[model samples]
Target: MHDESTKQPCCNPPWEPPQVIPAQVRRVNNLIFRKINQFHRENNVDNVTPMHDWIMSYLYWHKNDPVYQRDIEREFSITRSTVTNILQLMERKGYIERQSVPQDARLKRLILTEEGVRVHEKTMLSLHQTDEFVAGLLTEEENAELLRLLNKLRKGLE
Candidate 1:
């Protein structure tokens, strides 16, 4: 009763239903990351990564507040170790500094150095340009729907 036309070759298995969404999402994520990285590199802002840019922005925005490694870990949903590594690297690159708070000498707050602020501003401009370009590709309604669907997918994984 098997249809010979439906049979897949031995070297390749048929794509299952469950693989579609995740694969597509991953592809989109990778493509966006690469595009942003390339854009940054072209602008001669290649020292910091996309993640570092994000963290720097966070620190910049919350400059008045005391931001710590745990705060970053929570905000980004990344592991403590990963945050530590990224922060350490940023520190080594002179993008940030960990200063002990007055309340507790052991507790260090994350602060962006002057160079970090400059880089963050430069990168933010580049990112804004990229965002505008991507947004131009879709209508307002399509953009809203895309955001809703992306949030739903991310929430489902959470």
Candidate 2:
């Protein structure tokens, strides 16, 4: 005797709409990427590798140890071809050197050249300055909290 379309609702779900909070971290990351690209473009240093490659290369250089291409691939979750291309470009730019291991000629070890070391140092200094500038507006506790939250997010993703 009842029409399905006219059946009464068991309950009206609480009509709480989802709240939209400002994603400050996303905004900051986008700003940083933009600034880095702009800086590189203005300096005519955009070639040789992408911004991310430069960052990874710098980190490897600072570590001051021979690294395997497989390590880079694993750490960055990048494709083999992409890693090879970046390494080749960096090698051509004198930013890195690739040497075959004695025991296994098929495997290669990557070392940052002196020029790469200098570049890494300068880049790190600039990055530190930028970090200080950004954190200047935040209270110490806020800065710590931000780092903690970021770490938690990163771990969750991993």
Candidate 3:
């Protein structure tokens, strides 16, 4: 009544369960982080500020309508002094200007200079190109589904 196929070694251990999903997510996140950092550095844009920080500051500057320093600080969850420092550097670099609002002398409105506008446009184009390059690997349907699922996940976190 002995079955050789079912027989085990005297010290055989059980198999361990696999952790796949978490590992996959971690790998994907790492890949994205590395690629973005590499791209920014290779472009010589790893200067005064990191790519993400620059992008956020650009966004804040672009939202000129009702632009306020406090709003940017709150939106980005950054310190007031940090925002002030970034704005000052950007201004010094001739990217933006802080003009006194007619209604409020104490509050200054941020405006992008002509050069800043050109840089912002170029930056947007580069971002779009990067997006297309990455998404080109996926089929149209897969891209759509991935976007939808990502939005769902983001909303859930909110």
Q: Which candidate number maximizes lDDT?
A: 1
Off by over 4 Å in 2: 1-26, 37-64
Each model's lDDT comes to: 0.89, 0.68, 0.66
Model 1 scores a C-alpha lDDT of 0.89
Give the C-alpha miss distance for residue 14 in model 3, angstroms: 17
Clashes in model 1: which pairs? none
Error of 1 at 147 (Å): 0.8
The C-alpha TM-scores of every prediction are 0.85, 0.68, 0.59
Better of 1 and 3 by TM-score: 1
TM-score-based ranking:
1, 2, 3
Scored by lDDT, model 2 comes in at 0.68
Q: Tens digits of per-residue lDDT for model 3 on 1-158?
A: 88998877778556433446556668876665555555556554433244334534555456647676786676666888988887888788777778898999989877777766665555544455557767888999999998999778767865
Assess the local accuracy of residue 150 in candidate 2 as a C-alpha lDDT between 0 and 100.
82
Summarize candidate 2's per-residue lDDT along 1-158 as a digit string, tens digits. 87999775787544433332235656777787666555555554544234434545544644666578887877777889988988887778887788899999999988877877766655555555557767887999999998998878778877
Tell me the spans in candidate 1 whose CA falls farther than 4 Å from its real position: 1-19
